[model samples]
Target: MPNIQVSALAPSTQVIRFNRPHARNALSLALLQETATALHAAQNDDSVRVVVLTGDDKAFCAGADIKEMSNTGIPMWGQSERLLAWKTLENFPKPLIAAVEGYALGGGCEMTLLCDIVIAGQNARFGLPEVKIGAFPGDGGTQRLPRAIGKSRAMWMIMTGSLIDGPKACDWGLATEITPAGGALARACEIAQTIGDMSPIAVRMIKEEVLMTYTKSLDESLSLERKLLLWQTHDHNEGIAAFLEKRRPVFSGR
Candidate 1:
């Protein structure tokens, strides 16, 4: 079977599942390549409006496959293909949500940071335990974790190599919500459906603008938002008219 499985949850929502359950869905090079391929395919498929990334009940992902790394003697971060795969996720224009259960450590935690939203199960455990193994998170964990959960908490996780439960993750702002064990994927899919029902143009633009806020100055961010607001497409007009007419608006993604 494929290490990664891509399936349609709804007409507009696509799910990418990490299928290496025995290894706790570790991020091997093959899995990364497959994930990138699935993501690119979803990006180009007009029928797919939102993407949900998840793994099986046992684990979201344990992190990079240490055995593979030791055997190959290769660094994932320095590898061009792996870096490109991550970049593909970073540049994806559509909405991306992470459905996290069990372990999300090191590279696994970094993967969640790439998503626009994170829904974690009650059994989830998040950490950057690379330090314990004499390594550190090289896959956006150092940068994104600080931005998401603030400097102190991110520093604590990185330095201590300690794990936090799902509730604490939600409190720390790492997770948007916490569900019962094994419910994260369902919750994420539900949210994805709602997002898919909205204007695709607006959704994409909103995601772009939100991510842009991380690096842009306040004035620059506002300027960009204003520009997007003015570039309102047919969907925007339809939305306004639909509100006025008290009817559902059909968006063509124009």
Candidate 2:
């Protein structure tokens, strides 16, 4: 059976679900490759403005596949398809959202952190348990965790390998929203639809600029935002014209 499932929840939103529920959707090398391929397809499709990643009701992802990892070593240890898949995840240009329900541990937690928006079911569980396994989270966990939660909190979680629930995840800023159990996916789709209703160019630039905050200085980022607003964006012109005309803006994504 296929390891990943893709569906169109909306004209502009693509939902990718991890299908390995028996394993709590543990991210195996093959599963990651399938996910990467799906992401690449979504990235190339102009009609796909937002992507929502999720898993079955049992779990968003348990972590790396234990059987595979124990036998083969780390999944993304070096230059390989796994590493490239991670790179694709980190560099996805459009907005990506995560709808986390159950376990999102270790590499799974890191993947959630990679998303632009994270919606979690109140019963969702998140952690970095690799330290207990005599390994550390290697797939953006150390870096992204600190960025999501504060340094000290991230340090505590990483060092102790403790799990946090959805409410706590939101309180610590790791999750963007907390929904009732089983409502995360629905809420994420709702948010994605709202984003889809916006101008595609605006949505893409907003994602790009927000991600730039990590690599660029505030002044540099501001300057870049200003340049785009003044000269590079066609949507802004349409927005202003529509406001003056008292009509809805029809964006061409130019």
Deviation in Å, model 1, residue 145 alpha carbon: 0.6
Per-model RMSD to reference? 1.2, 1.5
On TM-score, the leading prediction is: 1
Task: Judge candidate 2 at residue 179 and give its lDDT.
Answer: 97
Clash number by candidate, in order: 0, 0
- Model 1 weakest lDDT span, ten residues long: 67-76
Tens-digit lDDT track for model 2 on 107-170?
Answer: 7999998999999999899999999988898898998898889899999999999999999999
Looking at candidate 2, the ten consecutive residues that score lowest on lDDT are 70-79
Per-residue CA lDDT of model 1 for 1-254, tens digit only, reads 89998999777999999999999999998999999999999989989999999998879999999877744666767889899999998899999999999999889999999999999999999999999989889999989999999999999999999999999999999999999999999999999999999999889888889988888998999998988778958999999999999999999899
The TM-score values for the models, in the order shown, are: 0.97, 0.95
lDDT of 2: 0.90
